[model samples]
Target: MEHRIATFLSRLSRTWLAAAVLAAVAIASATPAPAQDFITVASTTSTEQSGLFKHLLPEFKKATGIEARVVAVGTGQALDMGRKGDADVVFVHDKVAEEKFLAEGFGVKRLEVMYNDFIIVGPKNDPAGAKGKDVVEALKKIAGTSTPFTSRADKSGTHAAELRYWKLAGFDPPKGAWYRETGSGMGPTLNTASGMNAYALTDRGTWLSFKNRGELVILVEGDTKLFNQYGVMLVNPAKHPHVKKDSGQKFVDWVVSPAGQAAIAAYKIDGEQLFFPNAKP
Candidate 1:
């Protein structure tokens, strides 16, 4: 009886140990794993609207195993987000603003990423007679005729370029019905112009990818002033200690790298390339 009792005790001990191990395993299996590596990038609406991020970020993730999450806004807002330490990196156009951001110590440095030109898109009827004309002359005509012009007015790179053209044209567009401000992004502004049969300035990439173009057509292009250059930079870790510096720098380096440039060059719509890779080695 004593031997039988000892045997039964040993079996019970073994069973208890096994049950404890199984319970631990079940608890671990039920628990969630930590998040994967990721970095936040504040970029322009044109990049998002053109679907460049969708095409580019996946490849970046596949290559480096680091996910890039983008917040698409105007260049000004993107820089603002960097200033507030809400972003790990920034990618935007508008060289003047980018330079100012670097000078203000918001970013480590600016690296040119790509380039595209802006074009004047207008109604097919060409009421303002802007087609094939010089861009400044086209703006002047649009302003002079008070032809319905849709402005992004969102402090975007495209809006900045439009303001520069207006200044060069020697006039300030007043608040009126003919000159409408969308206070929105590039894609919506283009859509509004299309819907209203008005004129708007848009980057070539967004213009190419935009499918809602109602009666609008490219009216003016090929001006040297219309050149749009995009830049990338890591947010200053000194200002934002919480920033993912390593991940952000990796993203910047990858974007300017040869493989990244090739990837950017590879993205196309309907057999036409969008952004041209102009990053220097």
Candidate 2:
């Protein structure tokens, strides 16, 4: 009788152990899946041209396991992409347009990320004689001399700023030999200007990235009007219900975070810092 009881207890213990192993397998199979990994961002040519994303986004992906696919365009197109729900977020340099976007509820939680000054770039000969003058004065010369100048004219942030400079200079840029509008992006405008040996108003970052253009030189710089600030914002999920708010917020937060600022500060061309990180507010 004692032997039979002992045998029965041993069998029961083995049976329970097998049941526990099966239960563990079931629990493992029932565990929640890992989140999906993809996000879309619309940003400016300067950021793309400066190679900041290539330098920084891998770090973001490694940390968060979220892949960022960037669509690089002018600030106007980037904002428009966000408005049209083609992009999950926007990182751009036009403060006025960004404010308008927020006011219109197209985007939310707009945050300042970085800043850099715009400069007038032209042939080293300085045909307009714009060198060393202030931005407004330079524009006046560019207009007064009727020196060949190329304008982006793509409604980009840089284009908008150029128009502002023209206004400040007390002259509407005339349509003629002196003024040429290319309905293209910064890179293309730079190429066109270089081809024509014409002056162009451009952000510092794009100018730094423009290597093949040898004639272009920074003519007008260091003015307060040339101050260009870039901001990042998550598209309002309420407006575009498909926009991944979680991923967008993560991107915005990463860009403004200390790590992201450090990455921006570290990015350079020919040892020159392109963008100044303005992570505050």
Candidate 3:
């Protein structure tokens, strides 16, 4: 009789233990998961097409547990997004536009991050006699010869720079049957250039990563005026109270930091470094 009672108590205890385990699991299943930390960055298409963010964001996430969501567009659009408080950070290659954004109180601060030169790519056959000319001089020749040239007329930094060169070349917004404005990003404009065997101005980073070259080759480069400078800024929290100030500043700081500069410098294609880090001390 005592042994029977002992077995019944043991079974009862086992049943209660099983019931407790089931209750714990049900409670755990109903609990919500912790929200992930993330920030949105408005940046230029060159960084996205060049695969720079793909190479850098993973490292950033691993280091800070903050996911960076990038909206890659032309510099004009990127700055517009910042002005509208759609992004926490803006990373773009247009210093003048960025300064204007800051002056308008859309961005709090601007820091020069990295640089790469722009190059004018055209047919290797050199139909326009523009080969080996200085970048501005090349534009002059293309305008003079009326050679087919593609332009990203989306008000991007590239487009703005192309306009500057045209202005210097005595052609303000060169318009002709030969000048084609695609109103697209760098990569797509390059694709247009490649398709029509036309000349197009492009940042070196995009040109290095671009693989759709049909007859296009670098016809003009190495001009100091071709320098392409990139900058990063935090959206003004004063204007956009919802802006992720801390997180955005963190990204801006890290990008100019030695570690972030190293990551940018390390990105290469076919043994050619795409961007050179020159963040001010």
Candidate 4:
């Protein structure tokens, strides 16, 4: 009888041990793994609106196993974010502003990542009667007339370029009246221009993604002043030492590397290359 009791006790102990082991296994399996570090990127709305990020970031993530959190704003705002150490990196297309940022030590070496020209989009009617003319002359015509025109005025790289073009054209557009300052991003500004049947300057990429709007044709292009170049810069780690240096460097390296350049070149929308890789220098 004692032997029988001993056997039963041993069996119960085994069952309890098995149950404990299974519970521990279940608890271990239920625990989630730590998330990978993310690189915060502040970039121009044009790049985001053009669907380039949507098409390109997945490949980057797959290649590097690092997640990218992108914040798309106007060039000016993006720069501001970088200056505040709010972003690990920035991708913007304004040459003058980019130079200023580098000189100010807000960011480190700027890498020329891509190039795309801006286009003056307006109604097919061409109400301002400016088409097929030099960009400066076209702006003069647009400003001279009271015809509705939209300006992103968000201090975007596009805005900076537009202001430079206007200054070159020798016309100072008034704040109110015919000139409308839409303190918005590229996509919204484009939609506003379409809704108001006004003229707007837009990057080729954003123009390509913009749809569900009136027929706003590319009225003026092929202007030398309209040429746009994009640059990627790492936020100066000295200013914000907490900034992830390794991840930031990796992003910069990937952007300028041959493989990354090829990826940029391969990205397309509606059979149009939104950005041409210009990583040299």
Q: What TM-score would every model get versus the actual structure? A: 0.92, 0.85, 0.89, 0.88
- For candidate 3, which ten residues in a row score worst on lDDT? 131-140
Q: Candidate 1 lDDT, tens digit per residue, 129-199?
A: 98874889998888889899999999988899899898889866445689999999999999899999999
- Give the TM-score comparing model 4 with the true structure, all chains together: 0.88
User: Using alpha carbons, what is the TM-score of model 3?
Assistant: 0.89
Worst 10 residues of 4 by lDDT: 169-178
Computed on alpha carbons, the lDDT of every model, listed in order, comes to 0.94, 0.89, 0.93, 0.88
> Better model by TM-score, 1 or 2?
1
- What is the clash tally of candidate 4? 0
- Across 178-277, the per-residue lDDT of candidate 3 in tens digits comes to 9999999999999999999999999989999999999899989888999999999999999999998998888998999998999999999999999999
Best by lDDT: 1
Per-model RMSD to reference: 2.0, 6.5, 3.7, 2.9
lDDT at residue 66 of model 3 (Cα atoms): 90
- Candidate 3 wrong stretches, greater than 4 Å: 1-32
Q: For candidate 2, lDDT tens digit of each residue in 1-281? A: 99999999999999999999999999999998886777899998778877888988998888677888899888899999999999998999899999998999999878999999999999999977999749988888888888999999888899889988998898665567689999888888999999999999999888888876868888899898889999999999999999999988898888899988988899888999988898984
Give per-residue lDDT, candidate 3, residue 128.
83
Clashing residue pairs for model 1 = none
Pairs that clash in candidate 3:
none
